[model samples]
Target: MPWPSPPVVATGFPGAVAPVRVGRQGIYDRRRTLVAYELLFRNHGGASADLAEGAEQDHATSQVISATFGDFGVGQIAGDKPLFINLTRGFFTGELPIPFPPHQVVLELLENVEVDEEVMAGLRRLKDQGYRIAVDDFIGEPGRLPALGLADYVKIDVAAAGDAFDEVLALAREHSRDALVVVERIEDDALFARCLAAGADLFQGYGLQRPVTLEAVSLTPSQLVCLQLVRALTGTDVPIREIEDLVASDPALSLRVLKTVVSAATGTKNEITSLRQAIVMLGPQQLCSWVVLMLLGGVTGVDTESLTMVLARAAACARLAPAVADLAYTVGLLSGVASVLGMPEADLVDTTGVAGTVREALVQRHGPAGAALRAVLAYEEDEPCAITGTGHAVYEVSRAYLAALSDAMLTVGAVAGDS
Candidate 1:
């Protein structure tokens, strides 16, 4: 088990095993982002501990794949839209957990292992069966062509071999016309922008995002005051005229507010200038909405990481339970509050107004939604077997549905599921 980092990236840990963070991440695109991620394994049942005699079995080692990864595989990212995930050769050859969908989180076959006929045949089956295939860490291995042909995407580890980036890109182009060629592991702003220019459809790694600091941005004290005034309007009790007065006090705030008023997509546009007129036009409700939205959009970098995690998790849950997407959304949000606020889940669920079914499922594991919650948690843990009781658990369509629920959050969006 290791400590977790980043919003979306999760790694398996010995403790709660919430969402196992995977190292090495990339989104194919930011706006029209494709779902792509990497898993850093602590154990695949091949490690020494697995071989040790009478050693306490770490049967839970694959929990990350079951509880988390599976959620992303079944269109949890963007709702039936495609995403990509790395699949080790071992999983193909051996009994490794593959909790995600063949459609979403398209398998990026690892390069470290041999691809026998059986493997190729299986991949062909998956492709024919509607799975999207991808080749990982590909560096022009002629032997990989068969697999690549079945794959929908080819992930080139540009950072691993930067000197030969051009050649790899060339090879990638030849291999992928309908298939996407992703430039992964871009680690700096320069590299990020460069990859985009080089015909890269997707980008991964931490270089594009960094901690946002308000101090660094050039802003006058008056501007800061105006921004604070904008932010303060979010409180429900704030009056319209005061908000208008605050904006009027600073022309910059008024301008920002006016532009936002027209540009708002969710709410009707209101056009007005000056303090009192603006208040009358927008009214209290729309003003608050605009202020809150502006504040949120302004938050960047680490500031938004926790929000991303909550939203992504909820999105996965939504795919699992469209009927319960709202409940799952609330539960998912509450589940992470402890992580964000340095508290415990136990301390907050009662106060959160979480429905009885979700509360029981989260806490006692004894309610109707318990199994569903467990399935989602198990998929995150990489334990596809959890859906079925261990050895009793056989890969089935039901398990696939559970996996789909979580994964759909990433591919689709949050959906309310049944109890």
Candidate 2:
């Protein structure tokens, strides 16, 4: 990618063409509700290679800020929550007068970022502008006390916190009682419990979602019914009666259907009271969308973050390839559904009555739909990836995936409000 001088505003800049992409990992409150997301930045062009060598951090950081705030607005990536972004010392001091809304982003100062008079002054300026600051991977550096004092959040690595874990926590508490302590890499239940007992305000990691692998895992009767309901909704011949009956089988689901109909009803004068009427008014398309959301929500044993990622990836894949959008979505959702349910992906394919094309994509990752699925997964890994035959650049796929995070948040927010 061509590196041009930083623009004043992230929007409508006339510069050399280069694909800018971003990725995000959600940060959850104690209740597992998404409070923020840590933004991962990458420049798909050759300039980023120089960035990796520490020569072009300024240009790379500028592009990331511009892309999020200007190219794809903050509302498109993070709806109502703050975006946790990593900031170098250069961005802290040089990249001044931010153009994006301060409340929408949390600048995470890397551990190595200096805490000097100039840096502190920059931090003060950012504070004046209404932005929140977080100290990333804090390790209780005595010289960085001023930096710690300004932190709104302090992140600690649970896996690597050997003998100094308590010391770090003490220093953080002593410095700022207001700072939320976030413990990452809590890979198992024991560590999670330990962190909770030690008074962590927020937690993150794949462990919360995967927890323990059951030795003889199989789908329960209720879960089977949820999958079957999704199958019916997505089938060529919409099983309207079966779909309605399946939804009515669960009390919570029936109430959700009623609320959705009542809230989404645009022109109808009378309020929708029953599931049958709601189903008809919603139509097959809308009904299927709601069912898929409900089914994923009902998947037991998985944490909320993992479920959100699954849906977000599906939405992103759909946007990447609109021809087989629905199929791509199903592939993405089912990819994790088996793990969440403690069963195998193949078993889900056989049991859920998923279409043959979708099953092939899930089981083998072949065909056009599989090409899209591979691209989505690779982007989620936050690494370099190339999906052959997609006719779209990998960076474009990355952009789509980042955009999907907002959609997932909105859908989940609506469900939470109704509940």
Name the runs in model 2 displaced over 4 angstroms: 1-18, 43-54, 95-97, 208-419
Q: Which candidate achieves the best TM-score against the true structure?
A: 2
Backbone N/Cα/C clashes per model: 60, 2
lDDT value, candidate 1, whole model: 0.46
Q: Per-residue lDDT tens digits of candidate 2, residues 328-400?
A: 6656666644544455778755543335666687789876667777777666654443443445576677677
Write down the TM-score for model 1.
0.41
Q: Scored by CA lDDT, what does every candidate get?
A: 0.46, 0.60
Each prediction's RMSD over C-alphas, in Å, is 24.2, 21.5
Q: Which candidate leads the pack in lDDT?
A: 2
TM-scores vs. true structure, each candidate: 0.41, 0.44
| Candidate 2: 10-residue stretch with minimal lDDT | 5-14
